[model samples]
Target: MEFIDFFILAFSAVFLFLWWRTCFTKTKPKNLPPGPPGWPLVGNLFQVFLQRRHFIFLIPDLRKKYGPMFTMQMGQRTLVIITSPQLIHEALIQKGSAFASRPPDSPIRLVFSVGKCAVNSAEYGPLWRTLRRNFVTELMSPLRIKQCSWIREWAMENHMKRLQIENFEQGCVDVMEICRFTVCSILVCICFGAKLPETWIKDIDGVTKEVMLMTSPQLPDFLPILTPLFCKQMKKAKELRKRQLECLVPLIKNRRAYVEKGENPDSSMVSPVGAAYVDSLFGLEVPGRGHLNEEELVTLCSELFVAGIDTSTSVLQWAFLELVLNQEIQEKLYEEILEIVGKNGLITEDTVEKMSYLNAVVKETLRVHSPAHFTLAHAATEETELGGYKIPTNVNVEFYIEWMTEDPSLWKDPDVFRPERFLDGDGVNVDLTGTKGALKMLPFGAGRRTCPGLALGVLHVNLMLARMVQAFKWVPKPNEIPDPTETFAFTVVMKNPLKAVILPR
Candidate 1:
């Protein structure tokens, strides 16, 4: 088929779906929560489109005026926004079994490569639950984390040593880029049972960042009619994705070659033992789980790399920014570490657990800048009541978590950077991972889909922060103010990356 002809066909298909949805499909949900008046056909699209930042921020403002729950329209989609923890709990935890299923997806199939991810993006079902079970059992078990202590220690030392060197000529290290590279490398090793060299990860981070930094929904994603239109961005994503697939595929093949040749080494380590997660799907066995096809394995790996790279990296960048911007806070934390470890001198998992002040710094950073700003689009599977309004089946819902975390009602001086709030009077309940509830500081997100990599992420942030503070003295340039502006993207980046003079103490 000619490109134009294919385009025409795809447009006709989606146009019909939209037309049918508008004319025949039930449009009204009598029980749905109230929303700002929307224009016909466009719904509330104009309001958000004109001023997305100010408009989304209006949700909590509306809640204060309207109520905790209210409906908002974005084009043809109906979104229910809930701010109250009580309501959020009811939906995500109480009625979770029913609503946990992800809403049907369109863009994910066309633009995203990680199709049908189990833990992060999978629909709530047997497949999703099964994958979660496997992850918890094989990867996230406490014993496994303890075994990976050496991995954490090694990554942290490299991050610190590398930054210490960068502290010389640059005066300021791009801690943000370094953080992303280290985390991506760590997760690759964990999932694939082998480590891609640091340089390999550093190489791919730039491409992946380009792919993520584009905030506009891919043309192929937004306008259903555009798929046949010879899209360049889609083509760009494909070319980049192919390069990534090429890099990852060889590693899988090599592991297979090694295992087949009876060169198997580690059994106790979950990774690269016999059938790594990569090996399972490649072999179509998945060990304890049933057959997961090649597509499934590739999808899982893509999700792993992206998730590990963005979340761990963003948190670390924020932690460093906070430390540099708040020098007194940094020194106090170093003193706390000194008080506990004294001559222990090692920032191990055990030592990090004792550094309560260090934990607070990370938590504070998370509150200020959530990684996935929208928290990975959630949806309702069936009609449900929320905040006294009945929501219809298959409607999309989003919690403006950025709004929720920053709302004046939920936090004291919500804008200020303060680590002391996280400190308990007894100083023992410093839940750095936030396995317990943190009403306002949900950078890793909340509920069932809360980041699966939370343990590793926490270890990365705290260890990196502790070591950086202990090893170096960071000072802002004499006349320049720290640029706190962050690039608004999938994960936030410093709009003007943090630049400061550093002296190895």
Candidate 2:
């Protein structure tokens, strides 16, 4: 068929589908939570697409109109958005099982997820349990994390050297990009069992970034029937995934080879610190599956790499900016660090635990500038009810987590950057897991599906922030005030990247 003829045929089919659905199918789901009425067929599709970049920010306005629990129709998919803490607790905590599974991955996303095999993408079943259990116990346990402190220390040393060089030559440093590279370095060691060269790390980080951008919601994601329209885009996504595998597979093979020979991979680059994530996957057994293949290993490692690096980097960047803009806060944090660790003492994990003020600052940063605006899209395993409203199994349940942190009822001055808030009252002794106490803020989500890497993520932010402050006094560049305006780039980040002046302490 000619290209124009094919286009006309596709358009005709879509129009016919919409016309038939309007005439015969039910427009509104029964007993669904209140929401803005959607037009037939396309059904709020344009509204979501128009504000896709800032939709997380738009949830508050929708909550005002439709109450805490609201629903939106995106083509054939039903999205249930919960904004209130009570409803969030009721669904994810009170009835955790019904909502534990992840929503279905769009076809393109499955290419990266390797058919729902990664920890973050797996369904809540034997497979999910096994993956989560292995990851938490073998890879991210407190003991394992402590054993790998050398990796963080190595990355930290590299980070300081790079920043010192940049600050000396440029007068001001671009902290985000520098920190991203540093975090990538740390994760490469953890994921691959070796500290890769800067060039290799950048290539791996680069391909993962491209894959992440490609995996963001696309038109075919909402309506599978329209996938034909996105053939070119889908083709590009596959190519990116191939590039990602090419960058990572060699490291996986090398790690496996070293393990088979009973040797530590890249002994010169990495210490004999337990096993890397890839090392643990060699003989991993699933319920029906005996062991993971190379693609599955790559997928899981990629998940680990992507999950830890970007969010941690973004959080680190935000924490640094906050410190630079609020010198008093920075000094207070430094004083606490100085008292606990003393002058020139390494800010190890043990010392980090003793710095309550530093912990408060980290918590406050997470609350104020959560890297992700929403939890991974969750779904009902079966027909369910939330907040006295029906939740159909076909719907995707999305919690606007940023609103929870910003809710006035839960916080005093939600706009302020005051770590002191967490020093006392309801904020004190707050459980980040959100399984205990009230669900105030959960940047890593809550209940059964809470991020298994939560402990490691917090440690990364705290250690990096403490060391940065302890080593230097961060100040805004002479004529540059940090812009706190927010933007979404796979994660919530400062719209304007932070540039800071650093002085030796």
How well does each candidate superpose onto the true structure, as a TM-score? 0.85, 0.96
Runs in model 1 lying further than 4 Å from the true structure:
1-21, 52-66, 108-114, 211-230, 263-290, 425-440
Candidate 2's C-alpha runs over 4 A off are: 1-9, 21-28, 51-53, 262-274
In model 1, the Cα lDDT at residue 164 comes to 68
Per residue, candidate 1 scores C-alpha lDDT tens digits across 1-505 of: 9999976887677767666766687557687877788875447766776775734445656777767777776666677777666676667666765556675555534345455555776776666766676666555677767766666666676776777677676666777766666676666666666655666666656656664553245433333444555456556667766766666666666666665664545432334454355544454443345676444565676666766777777777777777778889978987887787763488777888888788878777877766755656677677777767776666777655676567677667778888887774312353323345544445665567666777767776787777777777777767887788766666666777666667766
- CA displacement after TM-score superposition, residue 312 of candidate 1 (Å): 1.9
Worst 10 residues of 1 by lDDT: 425-434
Worst 10 residues of 2 by lDDT: 265-274
> Which candidate comes out best when scored by lDDT?
2
Q: How many angstroms is residue 299 displaced in model 1 relative to the true structure, after the best TM-score fit? A: 1.7
* lDDT agreement with native, every candidate: 0.66, 0.85
What local lDDT score does residue 359 receive in model 2, on the 0 to 100 scale? 94
Clashing pairs in 2: none
Error of 1 at 390 (Å): 1.6
